[model samples]
Target: MKNIIEELFYGNIDTQARGFKKDSYLQKQIMIMSNSEEILTERLKGDDKKTFLSFVNASGIVLGESELDSFIVGFRLGARFIYDTFVDNITPYDDFLKEVNNEG
Candidate 1:
């Protein structure tokens, strides 16, 4: 889990941080927030897609277009990583439904 989160953070940040000066605020914030599992988990929990969009839209008000765009790309990559991790850890949907049906 930690490896996946780290990979997601560094992978996106490496690409997104290009052309910006080293240690820029945007890059710094990405590093801090991405390293935080709690923040990522909360951002990725129930209704995550909607939550991500809401975050982007809200942040856009204060962020420039390029920064907002970078954020969108990073958010998408993070969301996918979180989703894949979740899918890999959980039972298959069909199997879960079958178990629930049997129990009722």
Candidate 2:
């Protein structure tokens, strides 16, 4: 199975084709993060990790910091659903998780 970084880039093609600006700082940061697992993992710590996972769960939007609690709940449920529905049926979750979390 592909790692989350690969998955994000794979999914980026459509957005790029739709004329989404690819030169923004956030875009560059995402590319850099996608290529460097250590940097990505380091930035995604504690609340950042929770916010990120929540962003992913909500398809990339957060109303406010206060909404993070609800977002986290949904993120956990969504993660479990994905793990059971997809991860278990394909690659082991641990393997993919390890690959994404690895410092190197």
Candidate 3:
């Protein structure tokens, strides 16, 4: 969970830092909140797509729209790495935060 949050932070920073090309856009929008469910209705219809609900933050250098699968693969790898790291390092919040912050 912590690893996921870290990845979310990095991805969000990167997307805004570099700016996305109109031709190859990627985003990390909020998946949920304590607000109304109006805008989320259409998105919910696409829920079976599964990929849409996941908090995916990506940077696509691929030009043309045919490379979506490739982008999904990249996001999957990023998610798996985060999940694995969290699994291996699970502990109290303070300990985890301490190690994570001190790694650098």
Q: For model 1, what is the error of residue 33's alpha carbon versus the real structure, in angstroms, after optimal superposition?
A: 27
Please give the CA lDDT of all the candidate structures: 0.72, 0.68, 0.53
Residue-level lDDT tens digits of model 1 in 1-104: 45866888777436545475689998888778667645665567678856775786677676777777887999899989989888765644558777789999
lDDT string, candidate 3, 23-66, tens digits: 44242222233122334434565654344334321223333244
lDDT of 2 by residue, 5-55 (tens): 787788843422544376988788877756675565567889888776666
Give the best candidate by lDDT.
1
Of candidates 3 and 2, the better by lDDT: 2
TM-scores for candidates 1 onward, in order: 0.26, 0.24, 0.26
In candidate 3, list every pair of residues with a backbone clash.
none
Candidate 3 lDDT: 0.53
Name the lDDT of candidate 1: 0.72
lDDT value for model 2: 0.68
Error of 2 at 3 (Å): 7.2
